[model samples]
Target: MMILKLLAPIILFAIAILQGLFAEKINKIKWLKITLICLLLGSLTVGLIIISLDEKNANNFSKQQKDNIDSLRIENAQLKNNLDSLHRALTKGMDDRSLQEIELNKKVSELNIKLEPFVKLALTKYPAYDLQSALNKIAQDIENAKKLAEPPILIPNAQEISRDKTGLNMLLQFKLSKNQSLGQIIFYAEIEDGSTAKIVEFWPSTKGGAFNSGPDSKMIAPDGKSSRLIYSLIGAGNPTFDLKVTKAVTVRITSNYLPEPFITKIE
Candidate 1:
């Protein structure tokens, strides 16, 4: 635009000189008409050049504006995508946290249910106690109960040893100090004359019942002195011993609850 402004005056001056020289060579009226035509052409040429340059500049500006709009659109799309991704990630994280909390609560509930019985028992036993103290007291009480329920540990004492020669049998009497339920007893006999005595049957005079003995499941003791014969009898009984022995024999009676054995000699 600045270059066009500077050249406009120069172009007008050159046109005016050409027209003046032509006016001197032609008639006055014709010379005036020719000068008017030259001035009109020069103005038209300058106007066309200004319009062309303006159009070129306008086109360049429009192209740049379009490019800027396109860039902004792309940036806006990218921002939207990023925001969507962040939203999804946050939602998933919150869901995971909620699930974890639910699982933890469920486990706690199950544990509380399992402990409810013990808690009630403790509260009933110890009215004035904290939870921990009550639980400890409950455990100690359970241990005491187990100890009390155990059977008494005592060695058997054999008395009133007599033999009946007519029946060919021996009667041995024993009793448990504390009147408890009867347990199993294992007994065997060793003959003095180095003969093996096998027990065939056992009969007790006590009202409980006849004693039970198994001859098929007999086993020898580790010391080889007596054969193992198991008998189930009442706590107190005078059981008649029927054995296939021709010589004098010593009978030994033992039980799981006894620390020692009861022994009796019959001749």
Candidate 2:
């Protein structure tokens, strides 16, 4: 713009001199006006051309921006769809888990009801016994009850037993840490008296104390921690010189590890 301004005055002076010398015959004023008017017209034409090119570039820039926006919208839509699909999958998994839990609970309820009779028999006859052994008996019965309850699968194994330090008496026990998740389980056991028969007792080992034979499931003993149950059977004070040994009792220890729940008689 400065170069144009500098050249405009010089071009005007030359044109004016030429007009004054040739057409006006030394009329300088009229020739100067014509020269200035010519310069003004040339400046106007150049300015208009620049303005037109700027407007064309602006239109092209606007079109490119619209295309970029359209592409971004498509990508955004696809992302939203993927998120929705994942949400649906997560919700479905939670629903399936709840249904399975309900079914499992129902089956357990039915099994407990079917085993009620056996449970009462043990409670009445072996008033004194071990809780752990009772649980083991239940496991055994479950295996045995398979013929009656065919719908469920019960893994059968030989009853477990633990011998005492003297090797004459036995200890019995079972763990619910594995079966605890099942909530509750009921069991039963028996001591058959024969030509060789004996007497035994039972007690519960829980967050409670040893079998003081004083209370049911909720008793806590003097020990700081819960006691494992120990059931015992000692010889009846008198021994006869009979040739035939008539006193004997066959006891199935819950598992060899568990001993009967007993302590010095409270009496």
Candidate 3:
């Protein structure tokens, strides 16, 4: 259709040229010459109209193509922005999961440290087939131990407190159920003579080193069923006191993965 429109103008113009040439040849026939000249002018006018209409149609087509291209570019830009946003969301999710995995691993390590004593005892005393059963029993016993109102340990007394000639020393004993472990301990002491003994620190023995207090400490609980902790105290220069003068001792004890601390007072 486009080709036919373009050709139509040229065909009309050609016919007009042919008619003008033929009219000159028939100059002798005056009426026929006039008719041929009129035909020539009419064809020329029609050709001009066809050319103008075709040019206008071409311009409209070009404008419509430009508008379509602009719409396509807008859609492409929107798609690219959506893809970028999705990528950012996925990256953030992965980073969050990584952090959660690290925290879970830390908790698992702490649990293993707390349970090491029980696992070892079970392996030594029970056969391989009965090891799991032994661990279950140990866990049950520890739960039962936690339910007791009184602490399952002997409070420190002047007779039980060992003294160092150079410094004040107080020792307390804890007799735990089989495979039970210890978590945290804090102490408060009072003297009968109303004197204060400045304490440096108190700690339990794990293996051969002092047990540190904190979440990071991975020290295994005391082996076997009994454990002891000692407190070292300082005094003014050479202050000394008779053991009989020792009055009250209070302790806050936390044991074996328990969530709360237990306060025990000995008089």
Candidate 4:
């Protein structure tokens, strides 16, 4: 069909040329004229069929290209929608994280506000609250108090009382008026084994004279346990005791204006 279509126009032109060249001779034969006319008509019909088929094929190809382009556009639109969805999810997550951070900051601020009063109170009550030295001193005091609470063991015949000796001393200080004077005071000491005695011969200095106990006064010995004693002294210059014990002992001293026992250890 393609060969016929390609040669149709040439055949028509050749027929016309042949007719022209042998016009007088061909015209003289009716059959030859009729044959030439039929050949021309056949060539024209074949050319028209080829042209119609080519137009139909071009239309189909154009439709197929249009369909492919439309499909590509649809796929691109779907991809764009997916990207937009992903972007929206990421944005939402970021927003959520920001909100969480803001909430956390707000909670911290609220907590600080709530603790403001307590912080101020602590600062006022403990001026050196944040100081490491103050903290260490407090810890040491607590440890010492704990040690004082523990009971101690006494060594037999190992206790003695001495004067003008420097050992563990408990100095009692007092604030008094000049008009007021100290009266006769008594010293009492209790040992760890439930034994009690009147502490004598221990003189603590005063403003006017020294507070001295008689030699006949009983001597209270510490038994490496808790012991209590009471005395009366006035006018600033109070007496201190030189404690000597064979073993560790806790001494509780009570004097004038000193209701609470001042506890100490002699090691």
Candidate 5:
């Protein structure tokens, strides 16, 4: 169709040139003029056919391009809808996590409130027992509950300590100068009967002098074992023991608010 369209105009022009060349002879010959006129009419017919076919083909190409564009737009819309759905899912997950954390904190606070009286009674009545250790156990249980409530992907490793364990497994020895001695000792105590132990008083056995009272110093290990260190200044009228003495120094730790004491030897 396109080739015919291009050739139609050239053919018509050539026919006109031939007619002009035969103009003088046409007065002598009627058949030649008639043949030229017929040729011209045939060229016009061919040109009209070529124009009609070209327009039809052009309309078909335009329709195909429009269909392809519509398909691309539909696919793009579907992709956009999928992306929006994914974003909404992610937002919902975050909101759920936030609510879980809020509930967990509330439960922990309530547990602490309920355990306060028991903890106080244990501390007051059984100074030999470690009430703080029991409290720590309660805190750990709350933490474990919170962990269970969390998503599997966000859960952490267990942090609870064993019941059989007491103070830090590691040893700590301090060398004292003449002016200072063991003062206050804070430690995580584990009792064999499952009773909590507390340090009420510390004293030197030989001199009947009390250790200096102050804030507790705690030492903790990676495995959750811990102990405390206490030191004291020599009191008036109390005999000063030589730090270089080869003999072990005996110290008594009184608990349960009782006059009876437990003894520990330090070398």
Candidate 6:
């Protein structure tokens, strides 16, 4: 669009053209017609110039907007590509972690199977103190192999607590048997000032037994009549019918093969 900016020059140009075309054409000099023609031509020229300038400005503005839109589209594409790459990397890491966890579980299962037989054999024989100790150690080893795992020995053993007066005789008795071969016996007993103690934690000490005796094909329980090897008579080891004891004491016994145990108390 184009427009005439010099308003006075456009008016003079329009008047000259009107004079050249109609000065001699009028009968008695028509002043109304002449002025009307000059005024109309002047207005048209100015309107055209303004319209041209407005069109040019509008075109320039549109081009600038298009350029900005193109630049934004390119930036958006780059960001989308970056996001996709990060997603793929994170997916790969998750897959690797899943695979590692599966392998570790399989290994643990295998180890547990291997340890089962040794534990079973130890309990079956003589059902003595050492055999039970070995069973406990095996369970401990299993626990150490795994991180943040519970102790296998959480399963309670035979435990009891009792009190006896200074002059009164106290007796310890148990029914014992073996499900496996004759392994050495292991026993635990403890004397405490108070009768109350956490039976599972406060393990008793052992007194008498062929503790570490190896491969005893023949085993005997002191009572013989009981058939199964019930070793303790008075204390955890042995004593007569009347024995003096002070304070309260607890005792616990375990055999590797047997699921059950022997427990008694005296004070």
What is the C-alpha lDDT profile of model 2 across 66-166, one tens digit per residue? 98999899999999999999999989998988898889888898988876776776566556767556656766767877645432211222123333332
RMSD of each: 15.2, 19.4, 15.8, 16.7, 19.1, 14.5
In model 5, the runs with Cα more than 4 Å from the true position are 26-35, 111-267
What lDDT tens digits, residue by residue, belong to model 6 across residues 91-145?
A: 9999999899899888888987986797676565336648668788666766776
Which regions of candidate 1 fall more than 4 Å away from where they truly are?
2-46, 136-267
lDDT comparing candidate 5 with the true structure: 0.49
Candidate 2, residue 103: lDDT: 90
Least accurate 10 contiguous residues by lDDT in model 6: 235-244
Q: Top TM-score: which candidate number?
A: 3
Q: Rank all candidate structures by their TM-score, best first, as comma-separated numbers.
A: 3, 1, 5, 4, 6, 2
For model 3, the superposed segments whose C-alpha errors exceed 4 Å read 1-21, 125-131, 147-267
Number of backbone collisions per candidate: 0, 26, 0, 1, 12, 28
lDDT of 4 by residue, 1-267 (tens): 679777998999999899889999888999999999899899999899899988998999999999999999999999999999999999999999999999999999999898676566555656866855554555576688876654331112123333343333333334432334445444433334332322222334343245545554334544333333334444434334333433334555554434454454434
Model 4 spans > 4 angstroms off = 1-6, 28-38, 114-267
Q: What is the lDDT of every predicted structure here?
A: 0.65, 0.43, 0.51, 0.57, 0.49, 0.48
Residue 182 of model 6 has an lDDT of 33
Give the true-structure RMSD of model 1: 15.2
Question: Best by lDDT, which number?
Answer: 1
The residue-level lDDT of candidate 5 at 20 comes to 76
Clashing pairs in 1: none
TM-score of 6: 0.37
Task: Encode model 5's per-residue lDDT on 112-222: one tens digit a residue.
Answer: 899788788656665675878766665676788886654321111111111212221112222222233333333232122222332222222233244453454333233
lDDT at 15, model 6: 66
Error of 1 at 197 (Å): 49
